[model samples]
Target: MLAQPDARAAAALLALTAAFAAVVALLPWPAGRITLGAAVGAVAGASLLVDLGYPGPYRLPAFWLPFEWLALLGLLFRAVRGLSDRRVGPVGGLLGLAAVLLPLRFSLRTPQGGAAWSVVGVLLSLLPLLGVAGAALYLRVLDARRERAVARARREQRLEVARGLHDFVAHEITGIVLEAQAGQLPDQEPGETAALLRRLEEAGLRALDSMDEMVGALREPGGEGGRDGRSDPPDREERADGATTRRLGLADLPELVTRFGATGAGGTAGVPRATAELAPETAGRLSAEAEATAYAVVLEALTNIRRHAPQATEVTVRVAPGTDGTVELTVTDDGGPSRRPLLRRRPGAGGTGLAGLTARAAAHGGSLTAGPGTPAGWRVSCSLPGR
Candidate 1:
């Protein structure tokens, strides 16, 4: 209901008056004591007229009966409007129903007691009330749908920001961790340690840049930008180094593998060297969404290797055409000793990185799997649909 004091108090007063009148009307008073019944009916009629702003004479003769019912219906309409927007209890609903039916009391005042006229009159009044209530109910339903749509849009935006942070910052941080560990090796030369420090600086800068781009995406009125107002194509975003770059895909894997190999923990010869064997013409065969998801699969697998099996001697990243016009990508590491627990979960089976990539692949009509590879290794692989 409205917050206006008058609206609140009047609705409450009218409801109470309706309940009192109903009790009095139901009582079997002596026929000679007609004044008591008149008093109760007068109270109900006056309250309805005042609350509904009738502003006419409060006469109860047969002539002004129609106006009285009109005022009562106006009260019903207002009640329906208020109740439709609120959480009413069962008692509230029953009281509201009883209040509107008070118009039937008008029949007892007519000469010869026109009970049939009262039934017809009240039934006719209810038809319009039913329509108004239905309309109010429909409007309430539309409001609920609009609220749900807003909630859904907000949820998707949050997920997009979360995925971007996970993909970009995690990759750079993994590189930094590996570089730090490599610099700490006992056999490290001063020159090699200085080079690792430079790489660490670059990785830290890249992570900061990733965060800035994410904030910019949020502040930009619409979405990730292009020269015009239109959105940039998928998986492409502005980088710290420049205005725009293909953040991931077939074209980027060679550089990604190079960086992973360069960050070899404990030094170049001590840790696994990463290699890429990407098929020619595969980029032209895949859609942007599928290609980006493929790139994410490779990035996550490589990062997992750095975290789980830093001592693995051989790391291989391969992408090729699969059966029936599909592109397949795989990353495998020889199950070497790990700095962490030996009983680690397979990267593809369950990890935040791989779990997100699995959803992305499935969205692009593909699937991912991770488990033991041939001849003693852990492998993460996925396939995506191609043109």
Candidate 2:
């Protein structure tokens, strides 16, 4: 009066199990997926060997079910380890497919209690295999996001340090060099005493102070997220930040204007007079990014004028903010002599300054263009989105 087993149910279960296995096999990063696959193979081989040798009364061996569950646990471990690669899924699936056979065989053996029960067993066996694949995929996605975030943070830090070097430290050093050059030497004015020594001492102190701050900024943790984009610790140097009253902006243009005369020129041929025009609204309210970029564009342009256009004079700088929420900065020099060719002995000579500025602009979702100007000059200009 026992129930009759159904072959149709067993066949359907096997088909579903095979489909699941195939889907899992094709996953990427298949390295450790095979571990579960191998364990499944081992279970099938051992089960078949036991069935053949002791075919008498092994219908429901207590040890067989336990081994099967243990194998599934090993499979879960494989999935976790192989999370970074999708390729392991398919191989793992194949192992699970083999495992389904162990349960299928048990169902096919019993007289009245065979196929129907086997189908249920096969479905349960396939559940853990699918679970592992899903877990691996989740881990892979999490790792990828972490990597991207780290890379972005690193790029920002690099821009911060580079900007500090060019905008803060370099600008201060250049001014010191220029002032020292313009000063009368001790030998040139022998009778001059305390005043000249005092000026020299003050200039030296400023240079040293500026350099010490640059080094500290570079070393400080949570790097350079200040108004001026410097790297000091929070609140320690508020006045030192560009947000201070003396921060340079369009308002400082007149003070920045100077006449750069060619070093060896006779009279006026090589001397260039520099001028700046700032739109009335361009000052006081610009963001740190805009002010930094605009200041750098003008500084680099002037530096290049001295370095390459020693024979040409006349430079013009303009700062204008547009109605479309963008600030435009331009620096042009009336055609100076061509920049000197690269000194092959040095690794990077004439290219790094412009490249650094280009990177800085792009990081802020802005653009800078530098090339020969329309009529006869070299132009460096940038447009930055205003916050």
Candidate 3:
């Protein structure tokens, strides 16, 4: 469908052409000036004729000259006006009028009472040309607008895919990194950390899995998914796997906290104490994209706490179930660093992490905000649509 702006622009161009033609036709030139005026007008009108597919009326007999001049002039104005407005209808109609008027003009011009007939003929011929031009312009405008809208939509889809890749895969990979550093994997030999390395490799593979999915979607014919402008049905097996994967929602926050504790064991400062408050199925109900985004937000927050807030003894992960069927996940760390630095450090420190999180949230009709917490430390929170 043609958008409102394109439709209005096309209509305005057509209306202007019609009005200009009407005014020009109503003017009266003296008999002595008629031939010169018609000649000048024809030359000026001919300038616009190239845009038409055929030559305009200047070929009619002497008796029909006056009316032919009017019609040709009107058609020329309509064609030129349409071009100025980026429309095509007027040009097409002008072309048609040229074909009719050129022959009639060559045959009709005479010294007698042909002036009145010329005016009537010109008006009548130009009217149909104007109509044709208006229709062509409208269709062309609609087509151009539709192409632009499709391009914009495709760009948005790519950004969403990038966000999803960064959020889901990055977090899962970070989790594996932390776990490996903490020596949580089963030890196979006396001195070999082969088992831990294997677990880390497994985590890397999982990250790869998410990345592959995103890449597949991006490379798919339509950008997001599918070719030929159609979406495939959700695979039942994939949905089942996704449901199982989403089970690691807020309820698993404690385990994540413990894992952080293990990573921070060597230092004098302890790992931050964190908590989660969320509904049982809130994570599952969220679209795959939204869940991926939420996971990334939480993951980035934890990563920041581990990297920058080493002195912080308590970090809280709170997932509040909002009344409006949304979940607010906040990760607050009690560490020293004013609000300004927290804000400034985000772009420089987090790099693609924060940006990716923001894109992911936006894709799912959500928002992510990060800044300093109330009393002390930093806070990262995301308001995500729930299932």
- Candidate 3 weakest ten by summed lDDT: 236-245
lDDT of 1 by residue, 113-137 (tens): 4567657756776666576556755
Model 3 segments more than 4 A misplaced: 1-104, 107-118, 172-192, 221-292, 310-315, 323-326, 334-368, 373-376, 384-387
lDDT of 3 by residue, 1-387 (tens): 113324345344333433444454454433465532443344335523321222222322333334444544554444443343433343444345553454333224232435456566556766665665566557657766887999998998787676665555655655565554446434335644664566567668878877766665455343333333344433211221222123234545666665555444212243445555555646455655565456567777877765566556677777766657887888887783322221124354357777777876887888999998888888998988876
Q: Highest TM-score, which number?
A: 1
In model 2, what is the error at residue 66, expressed in angstroms? Answer: 4.6
* Candidate that beats the other on lDDT, 1 or 2, i.e. the better one: 1
lDDT of 2 by residue, 7-77 (tens): 44433333333433333334333347554445444444444443333222224432344454445445444
Over 4 Å off, model 1? 1-92, 95-102, 108-117, 223-247, 266-271, 337-350
Clashes of 1: 0
Best candidate, lDDT: 1
lDDT at 234, model 3: 31
